[model samples]
Target: METVLGIDLPTWWFLLIGALISGYGILDGFDLGAGAIQLFFRKEESRRIALNAIGPVWDGNEVWLVIGAGSLFAAFPLVYGTILSVFYLPFILFLVAIIFRAISIEFRSKEKMKWWRQLWDISFCVSSIVISLLLGLILGNLIQGIPLNAKHEFIGRLRDFFNPYALLVAITVLSLFMMHGAMYLIMKTEDRIFARLTVMANNTSKFFILCFMATSMATLIYVPHMTDIFKSHPELFILPIAAVLIVLNIRRSIEKRQYRRGFVSSSITTALLLILFAMGLYPNLVLSNADPQGNISIYEAASSTGSLKTMLLIAFIGMPLVATYTVFMFWTFRGKVKLEEHSY
Candidate 1:
């Protein structure tokens, strides 16, 4: 098949899938994080306020996840097959967490009984935490490179999921989500709930900074050739520098009780992380140290040129509409959530 505009179809698909997943992480990360932190509130009214704050937008945020998975299944079947088959356990756990959390969010508000609400709250919090950790672990595994055989299939055992580097990455993601959640709470709630969230943001931000540093150090030591990328591409250092600056700004914003500034800083921090991830997606999607020649470049993994052109046309028409609706929904729901109502 002739290449379209000199670019292969598979490469375009990979880029699309990557963008979708990353976007989902940035948007939904805060909501999940907020749900995880919901455990700290003792007052039923405060909990209601927290839940209501995210109620309108949480389900919409999940749309990006569905888009990402769908794109992978339709466009990059090989990558999807490998990931789903190899990471079966984590995948199942992630789905279960998402399901339970959704149920908890919907049911908690209907019940007037204290015990029933508490049970759902616990489910929501725990599920959020687990999902966030699993996402981190998946990223870690990808960067570390799964054990692929001659057929480019994963030969890794279940125990490999608990490796030290993977665990550190999971911690880093968990901390980041907590920080993101605190920022969302700062923006969505007011009065005593907002004040409490401010304190929570300050503490969580510090914890995340520590985890980020530890994860970076561990990745440097464990992932071979990763340091070389930094050394060779000195320009990439700007991303981490910007991330650090944003972290400091978040701290400053919290100190001044500027919720808007804090939220913006958190968003900037998330952007910086995404940039750093992009920096690592060089030469190939899955790098193999065992067989250097086995690296799966975007060009090699792509579909036919005709298929890519058609997909691009569809994306051009559909993506903008999706973005418009998402923005409109958030704008309509903008403002502080009150505790008087019990709906999520």
Candidate 2:
């Protein structure tokens, strides 16, 4: 019942968790996208440059994910428990991909053998692609509502995870990440690599636009609930309009050879899209496909007020430090990547 500003603690925690997840999507998304498109580099030199581009901060980028998961557990234990229990297989696969992707980056250059390097290259690309797709799959299913029983337990078949809507969302996410990664790469390379990435960035932008259009059409047609909030609150329609404008700017930035601006635009577009999603799913952390009564509202899933209050205090004290460290890390590694003897 305790409030921060005008909002209650649970709602504050909800917004905080959403912010952390958005941070993870923006930061880690580019590296994962870069990894997904690494194999397109062809030569070993090109691949190494691509790997080195993300090497200094790839692992650090995952800190947001770790924090986000921990926040979910602390803030909404019921929702967390149900999600992990029901989506056990997908979560496991996601963890495996994370592990493999990390190892691929670390071990790719440990050997000079063509086959050895190629092995990790494929692993890195596949793992990155899988991670992006799985993220989308999870988001899509969450938006569509899960088959939860009266107890808020997942009772759906595993096959339900692969429904057409979820698959479409997954592909859309992959395309978005690829475009995001390409923009990052363009900012961090020169000569042939820069030129190559420019073409790739533009192409991926088109690909993302195509997928985004399809996903928007599908969402309007199939997931009417997602639009309910906007319909009821006509003023909120600006968020999607802003998102569309930002998305358009990404290509404009790229066309002007403003890669950093393009990257920032991609990041903003990502944050806006997720914000729209969170707005649609507001109040309900997890929806129940089986029964609307089973839906786990944020108020229902949240911990005790005392716990939320204490965690909020800790978050305020701790989050700025995390942000500072992230900024310092990125600042230290700023500028186009250069291949050195010890580089990736």
Candidate 3:
């Protein structure tokens, strides 16, 4: 039970894994958001510009998801195994969406035929929307708890994953991503496309705000237990408060025509929301509705202390490099997207 600053190693790994997942949500989120809004740009040039805006970084952004999944598998094998087994279908669908998105981006510009381009464009848009919804749906079910027997085995049917709460969450997530993507496009596009996306961003911003408020109300009214931790630890209330302010700032920033600031606000908002989620689910990787005692505690699900320690060191060395590369890529490609011969 190696401890860092009074917290145990498993808890640290839990935080690390959560951070990685949050990183994916923040980085890849904009990419998904961008793709989700793809079909909205009507003209061929507009679509190409939107696609090229994310071209240099979309695949790189996905690396965060890969690393996050790897961290989960390595640090909490039990939780990983149980979650994958329980939600196998959604995860597989998520993968398929990711693949379609990647291929659509690559293949869309390869042909001059209008039908071929349109087909891939449609695939890209649908896949992106599906991916965002699936991510939210998976998270929603995790929050609500699954049917796990005494042996920690999933006893629920696949249909059980599509509960009301999960559906609401999925739509909320889609709205959030759409807004986020609009902000990114506003930053990366100019002139006609810029004007078009500004209107889209404003509309999407309203959509997100409404969905967020609804989701918050639903969570508080129905899933009251999630707020229990905040009640017990009032200091943690700052996180949600900050999240609200940041979300508000997103709209304000956009209104002020500070597109980059709006994008940054959106990214921060994503991170904060994920942090709040992790805070609520702290110490429990998965809750079992069938058997309360069968809930997968982080302590029980974690790997050996030695393994956590070693991986922490590896993460320390590796993560910064990945982050640095991410920053470099964005810095390298910063500005309005231009369609050249080499552009996607």
Alpha carbon deviation, residue 333, candidate 1 (Å): 0.5
- Comparing 1 with 3 on lDDT, the higher-scoring candidate is 3
Model 1 C-alpha lDDT per residue in residues 1-344, reported as the tens digit of each score: 44446755665566676677777887899988898899998888888888988888999999989988877766656667777887899999999999999999999878788899999999999999999999989888778877776577666679987888888888888888898899888888888988898889989988988998888788778885665677897987777778888888877887787868887787777767765765576546676544665566666665566666887789768777777888999999898886564365
Write candidate 3's Cα lDDT for 19-131 as tens digits: 88888998888889989999998999999999999999999998999999999999999999999998889999999999999999999888999999999999999999999
TM-score of 2: 0.99
lDDT of 3: 0.90
Candidate 1 global CA lDDT score? 0.80
Q: Against the hidden reference, what TM-scores do the models get?
A: 0.93, 0.99, 0.98
How close to the true structure is residue 194 of candidate 2, measured as C-alpha lDDT?
Answer: 89
| Top-scoring candidate (lDDT) | 2
RMSD of each: 2.1, 0.8, 1.0
